[model samples]
Target: MGFLGAPVVGVDELVDRIDPRPVLESRTIHEGYVFDLVSETADLGEAGTVRREFLRHPGAVAILALDDEERLVVVQQYRHPVGAFDWEIPAGLLDVAGEPPQLAAARELGEEADLRAEQWDVLVDYWTTPGGNDEAIRVFLARGLSPVPEAERHEREDEELGMPTVWATLDNVQEAVLSGRLHNPSTCIGVLAACAARDRGWATLRPADAPWPEHPRRR
Candidate 1:
């Protein structure tokens, strides 16, 4: 928590103070290809019962692949909802049931960047738009990268077919983040986390397989 500022309380005290609201009822409002819209009624005690709607996402993993030159691998693709070409790290949904998140990260790395990494670390985990979506994303820092063998390369399709892949220096990426040029949530978070981890001499990173008990997909 050094980079995040002072801690308010110890883990035990924080856990003891938690009084989670109980969900009285929940139902899927719409079933989509990647996610389902859910409406939930919860007992908020003093606030009384309330109803809310949100997307129940399957979760996702993003990879921040760094080459020996310290350039970060990125992709530019058009996102329909945003109606713009966004720069983002390699990422994909964790839709494969029972598959480990780290493995999903590796798959995205290969599919999006055509790269494989020998070293990996957990950079950060975050919920994208927590107020309306349960889309949790775990970002990984990958080093010692090499191109994926041509024999096992993944075929790009749809939006990925013409997407351009590029490498940017860490400093440039950080500048983009601060200058508001980068709007993709996972990419921005990953870049900032990687910079912090590097500044702290890489002590902030966790093992690639570290337990993520808070990730909703795991539960």
Candidate 2:
């Protein structure tokens, strides 16, 4: 506080808060199956009004499934935009009507890896790109893993067909992430968050059903 007579704010006080601006105008530029592009003009109080365009996402969930051996279950999926087969965690959009995020996470884990978990906790929630998209994603830590029955497994299609699933040590995943080998946002975030949570004995984790007020559907 001595620097320039400015008060020093506590670290805890830096928490993100809700302060939504009123939108003066909004228009959908293009609607896609996954997300929609929209333009908005918002009233910024004394700063005057501003117009911005962003993607209106439906939100998503990712699972950081850790096995008994401290290894993470990861998958390889081809992303056309990036022109690479990215290593990523099992994740899917929250598109289904009235489905809980946890349930959607379980469905994605089962569909992508044929796995199920007995315990679940929320690892982290974040916006993928706040400047240009409203894609809010929640990553969940899932343990006590088990395989889904063969007859009950989901059939893969499109980009998910023949996707490769790998089990790698957490340390190796961290190293790969640090080396820029894993480019998927969810994988990078989940891996790093899992490491941090482990260091704190996972006491900072939120309940699986914790509220997500930032989700578009919730708002």
Candidate 3:
């Protein structure tokens, strides 16, 4: 099955079972928080079948928080891999198989930013790094936040992996990205999606929009 002229490729059978050799591979073993060792063993043209082992994960989510005051809630924390702080949107992984992307988005907001949204409108779903891995990211826009005291939330090692919570206007976000303050790729994409949705008058970020799942226009 091909979407266009390119044939849809799928791993249908096992040929060779060998641990991926780092030297023979083109990608590094560890990237950021992910172990990204990719197998470079696909057929080119006249070569025999080649196969390699790789790790697979469920996928993840990122949330763009917008408020009525025109503020964007971001997080700043040091990423051990880069040895630098990243200002990014609230995001997390979906550990449970078959877990809904929307639920993961809502739960990540509570864990990472301590803010509850009345409504969440999904903006986009995409792959963060599509070269070798299949991990997809679901981006959501959360509005009508119920302010939970920042002190009440406990940071998990993964959540605290880089982002810790900072509030900035859209202008500030743009400036930070320009000044080397924000470096997370997924966050940047989410911010742009949020901005686009906001322009269409689709986001609700203040408490006035509270208890959002109850709203008729939210979905």
Q: lDDT values of the candidates?
A: 0.91, 0.94, 0.66
List candidate 1 stretches off by more than 4 Å.
Answer: 1-20
- Lowest lDDT block of 10, candidate 2: 210-219
Q: How does candidate 1 score on lDDT?
A: 0.91
Lowest summed-lDDT stretch of 10 residues in model 3? 208-217
Worst 10 residues of 1 by lDDT: 11-20
Task: Point to the candidate with the largest lDDT.
Answer: 2
Per-model TM-score on C-alpha atoms: 0.91, 0.96, 0.64
Assess candidate 3 and give its lDDT.
Answer: 0.66
In model 3, pairs of residues that clash are 75-165, 76-164, 77-162, 118-212, 143-204, 144-205
Across 19-135, the per-residue lDDT of candidate 1 in tens digits comes to 447999999999999999999998999989999999999999999999878799999999999899999999999999889999999999999999999999999988888789878
Candidate 3 Cα misplacement greater than 4 A, ranges? 1-55, 149-152, 155-163, 178-180, 203-219
Sorted by lDDT (best first), the order is 2, 1, 3
Q: Quote the positional error of residue 116 for candidate 1 in Å.
A: 0.2
Q: Give the per-residue lDDT of model 3 (tens digit) for 120-145.
A: 77766666654455566767777799
**lDDT over C-alpha atoms for residue 42 of model 3:** 56
